[model samples]
Target chain A: MNPTLDKLLGGKQGAIGLAVLAALILVVFPLLLDAFRLNMVGKYLTYAFVAVGLVLCWGYGGILSLGQGIFFGLGGYCMAMFLKLEASDPESTKIQSTPGIPDFMDWNQITELPMLWQPFHSFGFTLLAVIAVPVLLALVIGLTMFKRRVGDVYFSIVTQAIALILTVLIIGQQGYTGGVNGITDLKTLMGWDIRTDEAKLILYFVSAFLLFGCILLARFIIASKLGRLLLAMRDKEERVRFSGYDVASFKIFVFCVGAAFSAIGGAMFTLQVGFMSPSFVGIVPSIEMVIFAAVGGRLSLLGAVYGALLVNFGKTYFSESFPELWLYLMGGLFIAVVMYFPNGLAGLWDSHGKRWLTRIKPKANAPVKTEPVAKPVAKAAPTPELETTP
Target chain B: MEWLSEFGAIAAMQGFNGLSVFCVLLLMALGLAIIFGQMGVINMAHGEFLTIGAYTTFVVSSLTEQYAPAFGPYYFFFAIVLSFLIAGAIGWLVEWAMISKLYQRPLDTLLATWGLSLVMQQTFRSIFGAREVSATLPEWLMGSWNPTETIDIPRNGLFVMGLTILLTAIIFLMLYRSRWGLQVRATMQNRVMSRAVGINTKRVDRMTFALGCGVAGVAGAAFTTIGSTGPTAGSLYIVDTFLVVVFGGAASLFGTIASAFSIAQAQSIMEFFMSGSMAKVLTLSAVILILMMRPQGLFSIKVRK
Candidate 1:
């Protein structure tokens, strides 16, 4: 009834969708799944953060970054660093050649903690670094590429190259970055032992809350006038630039937002998974993250979340049962989605599922009669406010 | 005097090694340049095509060894030709099935090609098993061409170099001197206009893609001389190949050659001094920095968008 609240929730339809997703994630998942499965869901939710960011960056802004994993890894590594330092206290590590530094460093014969690892000793600083580090890198990339008018396939290739470079650098600098094994044996988080089931459950809820917060923030942005400009920019860059709207800055802004969201996801992932590795920070994982958004209906923020869950579920299940078939299935999904289902599950729902729902319940058909006329506008333009879910 | 001569020999050997690398890169980048630069289609499965060639060589080597041992030495030449034809045929099929539909959507094409690459990799894994396999080279292709005591170059390296030179020359000749080259150039410059002028632009696109893929197959055959082939071997070089093509300025074949040479040399030289991974990181960083500064790349022609 209240306009501001209604707008924040993306009108009545978005409100209903948000409520259903919230109930599914917070209530249903927790009630139905065991701690281990719920933790896995939490991990998937962290990826959902990147998927949501992709919805804004690739779907709305049309800047397809194939390197969101870089930001996610940066955030995860930052959190891992702080936890690793706390775990590597002089008491627990007295047998080592170096008492206070990470075990990987000591293994590599380094005596002193590197200058880069020193600041991560402070949790406050680590928290800031998680977001700031990724944003800074995104800023540099955005400024360089966008300012010079490098976009489309060029930007994607450059980002993919950057992901490759970061992965190689991390793996090569094994002593400093824990090499290929990644930052492992992470036990405590600021004196809280995260290995416990109770701790895992709490963390899952915390992640759920954070995810909802991100979705709302994304919804707020999409509802604003700035969102319209992003749509305009995606469709016709020249027109937006000619209209004196400094198109590059808007691009940089959305890209940074995406990077920031991915970084948050990364930090949460480390907290839940207890480690971070180059396997997650490379071209493959980065592109897989894109597919999460793709399968979810890139245009719908909530759909991206579901896409991440469904794809990761399939990956885990198929890989565990039939490892040989997983890659083929994943590959097939990518091709099939691109060819026939570009709009993803959400689009399918809009085109067919909603019509079926109305027909089943004729009493609700009156309100739905007006929807078909407005449906094309929402489907065609995809201004987030107009997106409806049943 | 003895030490100076030894140092000279080592330098010469490393330089030759660099040259060998340069030849491989040029072969890969040449195919990529035509596909990405000329047609504006980003084929992420380009590496898989190389794998197709490599696997084709592997199969030919085994078959020749099994039933036709007398044809061992000469089988390689036939294999190379077969690799080109097979890879080109698959490329033609891919163009018809998937690529032609996504010409307007470059990003989607990238995703779709990546999918194609995954499927191809799985096929390789299924057929060849997950282990790395190499072709059995003939005795003449083994051993070294020793210029000095420390500067012994493998004969296979020289052979690969010759093959690269021959292919590069043929590609250049086909691109510049032939009637097909004119149609390709015309199609690239203005597809709609070329179609209006009675050029079968669609056929040109298909042929150009297949030719690019065929070149990749030849590159794969060359690759077996220097390294073993695996299911994902092609992917390892995809980024480097793309960088070479980008650095060379996508549209120019000459630029691809130049970029490949410089990049391979830089990487090999740095590799000699530092750890191989560090050398790669530094070389790639330098390339990215340069690319950021000059987004059009090293050898772009001025053309109005």
Candidate 2:
């Protein structure tokens, strides 16, 4: 092996080995764990989807979108709406009289299904809508925002305001949207009985598969030129603009991609949980998304996944074990994360990895660093030039 | 002519209601403005601080009901003070423990404060049992003051208006005229220079944060008179409070007061004409349009680049 490749792979081997071990645990542990625990992990995996999107937008694109929940909620609601329609008894013309119309709708006397809810009866359309609606919303908003050069704190505030408005809008539309009660009592997903243990296991497997796919996709994007351009825009937008890149297009693209990922997460979330509500898309949940990404290490894609799982697991455990003190504990955790670990857990591992590598191979690394610049530099430049020429 | 007279009476009632709403909104936004305007920290827990104050008021009122029935209406005054202190103490603790560390990182503070709000909410829920606490109003606060035969304004609302004006004046004086105000302004404008000038920047941050929380607490106390108190009640006010603060511009005190007056009036008028939820949606949509036009908000001061 080349000396550079040897050095790169040498240090990463332990971390990669640990990751593979963790992956094995994840896949095998579900079989051994109870259905409830499997379901919890499934939920965490769905959340990890949102976290991955957040990492792209916030970690790489320099956009602190505190409205991932809105997209997530939108996707979930879309799926739930379909499931509700499918589950509704067609013989019962008195849909309004039906308790399943949601309590708020029953209160509102919405006797008939709204025209917009008609397409949701189809599973395929519902799936498509789950992905389409949030991405479309994000595309429009992102285009407008980025075109106006809204960034930093201003961008965060705008997204937060959007999340707030979306929540309120959903709640206000009591007739069709189910208002505060939201869409629940979901019995099935595309003919599969959702309540069954076997179905639950399948959902968990699907969630795990989707999560792995998202991680791989995110890693692929980060390795691509588009990701490089995004990072460049984040680090120095004006410089990138001067270098002939459409910064707005890049931002809008990444933002839409992020929104789509969040929507997918939401769809999976609704399928697993059998419910969707306005509460999930509100300002509080949106902020929680940011906190998860932040605590996990926004810079690393893996960190985002780990962070979501850890924070959510903590939330589930704390809320169950110590319901009253859960909030205080979460608050304390946030404060501790912000004050002490600005670079987050991933940064800690990165530094430790470097230190360990140096201790193990100090002599080998020293000679390579001091003796090696000419050949690599000469070889690296021509590859980029060849790509550009082509 | 009779129809016009009926419309006039309705409008007048709405105006008074709007003013009362404005008072609470302005008070809440005043604290938000001071923190965001001065320190640039979007304190998401500001509403929770208000909830804390309302809870304090409930505790005080309960104590008075138990111990000193003769004191009666006067218990409200004690509750107001105690609420302010309690909320302020929590604010101080939050600032010292969490917010102080996230000064340069305003976005981080927003997330941290949001977490704090959730914790506060859950704590209150665990303690208060997730139900609306019905606060008893004194006889004086119960009835409406009849300005005309058809138009009657609630006495409590009028009191709230008066309290709002008095607090605004006091806050204005302290922010502009006092030595601490000078230090605060100096620090807000240039932290390094303020520190160089021997100002205790950290102390200013704590005190300012506390002062803002105290105002929110007072607003909470005032709110108990008009609205039901519950663990989740704070969430209702948060969006409205943020709208007021953002509409007014984060740091501009006068802007906060102005925006509160305008937004409250608009919302009330809209509510009279439309459904409550529709009115809120309309008002928020209008605010968004206005923000897109003027992102700095109305009466925004140009800071040094």
Candidate 3:
């Protein structure tokens, strides 16, 4: 009983922490916010998916991918293509020279649907492509780069370049991609009107549930011995390699998983936001995704969710009132987070909030003895890392 | 014979354009390499400092045009000097306040400096407004050189190229031949030993960082001749600057120049035939592929792990 609970939650503290976050996501947010605000929260939650993946890939495996938006966009564009095909039926586009292709394509004088958009006609195929394409691309990148032993900074630059290339391609190909405007005017999903308020509420819950499931999956991975090995690799690469591990394969696996995770977020974002664009696939947004991870506490998956919410909320609030000031606040957050709070909200909670918790609830100390001990701090904390991730 | 001459003129003009891009890239990449390759601090705001120089040039030009019209022809030289001094001064303060504490954490430097870049960009927007502004070039720097009827090179482009060559020579000499250069190199190679030998490593660190930023300011001054400057102009070139520094092998000045020259020329030439976005895609993909094959970069720089 104890071991199963530990495996699922790390310890009693992790269990309680996860429960509180789950309650807030499920209850507090929905109850307080109006439909519009809830929808904004849903969009921010999508970014949390990428931030959670960052925690796994960067925090543990020591692979910092600055181009996560590539996978996100790939996943989103795949879904967008399928929806666009559904929307652009021959009946809807009869006014154009070409009746079967999308409006943008007809506007650009494209007579027929391109071969690339044909496969997306099938929902099942599109869904599979969303996950498979990003994973495949990430696998190729990981294997080629990691095997050659590229350093961290170089890997980051290469990923960023890939993001830039993808954005440019999407923007340049007006007829094929709808150009810089991105694929829009999405109406239905599987013949159901997704534009209704009721439908949006349902989608929000669905997104939240999927995010929790990802949180659990991430929690499980970090709790496993493989996760520990990943941390070891980050701290000391040669020492971990000397201990008879194929570090390259592990790195590749994590990268593929990270791609898959971000892809899921992208798909959900398309569903909630009802559009996908090259703007999200570029360097600026990709780097902003990293900031989401950083602000949430790079080591904590749960912190990532809150981080995304808080930052996005601040951005929306400030930009609405004072457009120019938003940049200053965001820039300040980046500097403050990096300089003083590297661990992010999770770290702050661990260092300061724990003492407060101890004072408020004496019963919480019951699990302290049962919790696992530290490994001596080596630039990272020795214990309570599980507390960071929900 | 007429058609041949037309093609010849096209090739010559493109070649000159490529040379200008190469010069700008080299100047920017040199500053970045010194900060990143030598100091091992990835200053993402290197481009912002370069922007500072461009803005400085703009300010000087506006001043000379409005207040000191007679000084118009010589304003550019003073602008370059002022840009170097102001940017270098800021670099010194940044090193003192932020950079010194974060040298042990390289990735954190990328984050902090990125934040710094955004702040600087927003500051630029606030000060200069969101619109792009171009500086007025002196009469001597304007127009083109008609070296035969078939070939004409822009005078500003030639002047910028010459400036690049002169600065490169100066940087090479300062880094290798000067006493301060020895101290900086020694401290970078072995901090403890250099400190023990009375190198004043902290002072060396500040000076080296300032010098790199100073050169970037000069690059920004050169940029005014080729393109318009805006709040986000520095950002548009920062990533490309980083790629150039990395591809060249961070440690080698010669490698930086070679990579910059090739990247500039390739992009310039391809842009003529293909769409701008396609050219970027092709060039970036090629660079990524090459980097994969040779992860150590075009040249290897050995340092103890």
Best by the lDDT measure:
1
Better of 1 and 3 by DockQ: 1
lDDT of each: 0.92, 0.81, 0.89
lDDT of 2: 0.81
**Model 1 residue B283 distance off true place after TM-score fit, in angstroms:** 0.5
| B269 Cα displacement, candidate 3 (Å) | 1.9
* TM-scores for the candidates: 0.96, 0.86, 0.95
Model 3 lDDT tens row, A1-390: 578558778588888888999999899999999998899899999999999999999988888898999999999999999988888888987888889889999889888889998899899999999999999999999999988777787888889888988988999899999998899999899898778888889999998998988888888889988899999999998898898998888899899989998999999999889999999999989989899989989999889998889889888999999999988888888889999999999999998888677755855655565333332332276256555434
**Which portions of model 3 show Cα errors greater than 4 Å?**
A362-390
The true-structure Cα RMSD of candidate 3 reads 5.1
lDDT by residue (tens digit), candidate 1, A48-90: 9999999999999999999999999999999999999999999
Error of 3 at A15 (Å): 1.3
The residue pairs in collision within model 2 are: B37-B251
lDDT per residue (tens digit) for residues A1-390 in model 2:
654443322336534843663575366767577998888778877888888898899889988898899899989989888877656654432545754443445668876667898788788898889889999999987877788786477678778877888888888887878888888787777667898878878888887777766766776677678888989988889999999989999898888888988898998898898889988898878878877777888887677777887899889888889777777887777766767775577776676755667656856766666446744665777865353232
